[model samples]
Target: MKLKFFGAAREVGRSCILVEGKSTRILLDAGVKVGEEEAEVPTIPNSMLQSIDAVIITHAHLDHCGYLPHLYSNGFNGPVYALKPTLEIANVMVNDYLKLSNPRDVNKDWQKKMQRKEKTVEYHQEFRVKDLALKLVPAGHILGSSMVEVRLGNERILYTGDINLKTTRLLEPAYTEYLKADTLITESTYGGDKDTWPPEKDVLSGLMKSIKTTLDNEGKVIVPSFAVGRAQEVLFILDDYMRSGTIPKVPIFVDGMIGKVNRIYRHNVIFCKDELQKRILMSEDDPFKSSNFVMIEGKADRSKVLKHQGAAIIVTTSGMLKGGPVIKYLERMGSDSLNKLLLVGYQAVGTPGRELQDGAKEITLDGKKIKMGIKVETFHLSAHADRPQLLRLAGRIQGLKNIFIVHGEERKMMELAAALGKHYKVTVPVLDAEYTT
Candidate 1:
């Protein structure tokens, strides 16, 4: 088998990988990197597009599935396999990406065609596409996220796509028992030796404390979050804390695409953790429909929300503060030192959020430099596995001989490779690099 890296080889976005067996060629993911200036797609050649027999999507995150519509537009009409919820969520993510970034490349006709090619597969359900036997296991990163296992000829390959080994409030841990693979392809998003995560309880406590301080001072709290997994997780934390009297009751405004994705999450509770499923199905206390959480309908409602008298929590999208309604809220409420901006996910370099995190007092937004005094705080509520968790996961796969690390910065990838080099033949492939195994 041969593996090729088109993107996300030593970076954190545009994750595309091609696997070529003796008789079949499969694309693992076709994604785009949402950058400061423009989006970046994979580096696949035009001649290779028609040779791909099928595409397997590991999750719905834009970094893992955003470029799929472009594939259809480029005349690749192979079957796309994923969990049902991943497809539903990817529909929302890809449409939003088109409106923001590559509007001219995709049309309604291409979208319909892509949807017609979708093939939903359940966890552990074995399926065959041409010469490859495949199965998906839960990846615990988000709802419907999975790791792909492929068997061809006499070799087995396991691809870990944005995995989280530790369980959180929403999902179970990644499945890693009785799995055998000769080559392991994994992500190294947090693979540095110093990238250990704090305990979950402590992280939650710190986040609540920050919010409580702002609320006590009668200031609204603006939480810039990703629309899919991080937004939903933050909402649940706030609701659960409010119900337990850990924090005072306050209006949690849901903006951007978060409210729509929340409904998709609620509808697919079967993919969530056992406790989350029980809370949704076994009672009237659905966290997704919390009374304290209100949806901002339109511009009129957003204006009304900004004019409210008391303290509130606004959870909006464009997590990196590159775009979306979060910017509007920041413009209006940012000067107030009492108000707070809580970042709940990874902020990419060159983003406005990263600037704030790096202690920048002035930022340029849409060709305008704005001065701000809002209190900015970051809580490490990440969904990716840390260094220890990654090592633990690698230690579990039976018959693993080679490891390929992708989806991280160069330094962190090297650190992880050094750690894993003692046990296995680890290779950190560069962009467009190909290797045979």
Candidate 2:
């Protein structure tokens, strides 16, 4: 068997991997690179990509599945295997991704890149092509994320798209059956940090304290969250705080694509924690209908948020504080000492969000330099596991053979490789690197 990393080998954005064996060749994921630096769109070597057989998507996040359309446009005819929800969410997220990006770059290359799209499959479902048998399992990272196990010839290889071992407010714990594998390809988004998160209670308390301090001074709290997992979690945390009177109930403005995605969340409540799903099916415990989330509607109405009576909470998208409505909110509310910006997700290098978190006093936003005077506080609410949790996850799998770590920075990937090498044979591949076993 041979493994080739076309992308996401050195950094956390685009994730593309190739496996060839047992009369089958498959692309693990064709994700896109993101962040501030002007970057070239990623594609596989023309030599290997021209006649690809199939693609198995791990999740619907842009980074995991965003490059599908580009792949199809580049001349690859293959079925994309993913969970049902991954398929559904991918449709929404990818189309939105294309629509939201620059339309001005309509050259032949750009046109071809966006010309074709992806097909979706479901979980536990099996797909066979030639001699390959692929099974998708719940990954528990988002609504439709998955881990995949593929059997070809006599080899059993497992690819974790992106996994979360611990259950969150919205997702179940990752599937446990694939604890045995001959070859395992895993992600190392948090491989450098070992500290497990503090108790949820402590996190909640800290969030409340920050919000309270801002409210006392009558400042708005602007949170630029990823429209999917992070947004939902933040909203739930705030909802719990307000319902229990742990903090004052402020008008929380819901902007960006998160509002639409919330509907998708409610529609797919079955994928969430069973307890939460049961509550949704049973009583008046509708978390999405809280009075705090004043959905901002119409483009003209955005200015009215500043007209609100008291301190407000605004949740918008483009998580890394990169773009979207968060930019507008930051431009309007960022200079106030009364306001605060809480970063809750992984901000890649060179992103404005990362710059802010790194304590840049002023940043250029939407073509203008804004003095950042807001109280900025970072909380440990990442969807990815920390370094220790991931190491623990790696240790639990039995019969694990070759471990390939991807989806991290150069430093982080090396750190995880070193840590996991004490026991397992850890291989850290460089961009476009290939390994045979």
User: lDDT per prediction?
Assistant: 0.90, 0.79
TM-score of each: 0.98, 0.93
Residue 349 of model 1: what lDDT? 73
Tens-place lDDT per residue, model 1, 252-331, is: 99999999999999899999999988877888878888899999988999999889888999999889999899988888
lDDT of 2 by residue, 297-399 (tens): 7576678886666688898888987678888888878888888999988888888888999999899886789999998898888777678767877777777
Best model number under TM-score: 1
Q: Could you tell me how far off, in angstroms, the CA of residue 186 lies in candidate 2 after the best superposition?
A: 1.4
Judge candidate 2 at residue 20 and give its lDDT.
84
State the displacement of the C-alpha of residue 289, model 2, in Å, after optimal TM-score superposition: 2.4
Clashes of each: 0, 1
Report the CA-based lDDT of candidate 2 relative to the real structure.
0.79
